[model samples]
Target: MEVKVPKEIRDYQESIFFGLSTRQFICSLLAVGVAVGLYFGLRPLIGSEEVGWMCILGAAPFAACGFFKYHGMTAEQAAWAWFKSEFLYPKKLVFKSDSLYFDAMKDAIAEGEKPPRKRKNHKPQPPTGKER
Candidate 1:
């Protein structure tokens, strides 16, 4: 006779195997398959060393997706979001004018004068009754 006790529930999700969730497992498999396929397919045409590198390049993206996480999102999702934000709609398009301080510094340098240095804002306190 055998008895089984139910395990306690955790607040966070647990991995199905080796710290990899189902999606991660699938991603890892896909990455490995792609790498192996590429390596084998390219081996006859190119050197084995080159094929190995090609395998690495082909598998790196899915490996990243499988093995990495970002801000609670899967790596592939984060990567897509980043690609869209960076390439489709860049964040640097805002029309902000450059600061004239650097230009002034450059002009001063051209005129053979040293650039003005910024001073720290440390004001001396009036005589405190308590001594350090």
Candidate 2:
């Protein structure tokens, strides 16, 4: 018998039921519960067809949480990161470097003194007749 193995050991998740991990199974159960609740609660007020659509919409987020993964982060982690980036820290961070050389030369530059041109230390000279 050939046993399946994941390329990355960390990616391996033991299937608890119906080929779903424990977390996935739990989320699926929660989604089903929400869908059933929505269907029964809304069916009386709205028609069966409308309530069915509402159940799907209501349960989708719960189901997505189990399946969704981004950049190795779970849905909840990604959601929290997004919330922090958008609400808690919304300002754009720009990097500004402080150059001591530039700061020292600013006065001369403003006074219109052109910086000295860089020169190569080693210049090619005519080859000597003597060979090594």
Candidate 3:
């Protein structure tokens, strides 16, 4: 069966996808630039030494972190994954995906809604559980 997204979901998905992709691209570029800078900056410190190994070792982690942080994962997914991987194993993937999907749904709904009233307790709470 074919799955179709509602207009609001489609809009929110498109917006979020574009926003996330842009941020990931920029962050990846910045990470690479920082790595390059480290290589060059270390040249003076290491006295033109073949510190290629140092650069690789040090920058690799940063690059990995940046990739995992911004590119390979979404903000919600990453946070959930981190929580699961760090504290809860075996059920990590299951929980994270469910939570992320729920969050995405809520974001789509919120994006489609009219502006909230300017009154106390009017602020929308972030999505929680599976309500989205």
Candidate 4:
């Protein structure tokens, strides 16, 4: 089935620069900025090339984070969505012990109340004598 996505979502997914969307392009720029900043800041304490390389390596994952997608969502969007789902307004959850105990208690109560109900697919028993 073809799912109809909103125009806004489609627009957000469109590539504006090379293969990167505006958000992704901006994120890449920010990552480069952070790498440069780290290189410069740490050059005095460490060696220039070593620190620069380390900074680039470290910033690579953060930069690439915006380049992928999940469930038709951009990587950044997916990550943020996951964060929200995990921490903010989570769904109701039951503990294993509670669920097991509740299920057993429910079964006990149901057993005490009644026997099995006849199903629609149940066939009537055939008579052995006159009634067939």
The lDDT for every candidate, in the order shown, is 0.82, 0.93, 0.63, 0.79
Regions of candidate 1 where Cα sits further than 4 Å from its true position: 1-11, 87-132
lDDT of 3 by residue, 69-118 (tens): 45456566788887887888854344335576567578666778653457
How does candidate 2 fare on TM-score? Answer: 0.77
> RMSD in Å for candidate 3, one decimal?
24.9
In candidate 3, stretches whose alpha carbon ends up further than 4 angstroms from where it belongs are 1-20, 47-50, 65-132
Error of 2 at 95 (Å): 2.5
**Candidates sorted on lDDT, descending:** 2, 1, 4, 3
Better of 2 and 4 by TM-score: 2
Q: Write the per-residue lDDT of candidate 4 for residues 34-65, one digit (tens) a residue.
A: 89888888888998778978898878876887
Candidate 2, 75-130: lDDT as tens digits: 99999999999999899889886999889889999999988879878988888989
Model 3 — TM-score against the truth?
0.33
Off by over 4 Å in 4: 1-16, 95-132
TM agreement with the true structure for every prediction: 0.52, 0.77, 0.33, 0.51
Better of 1 and 4 by TM-score: 1
Name the lDDT of candidate 1. Answer: 0.82
State, as a TM-score between 0 and 1, how close model 4 is to the true structure.
Answer: 0.51
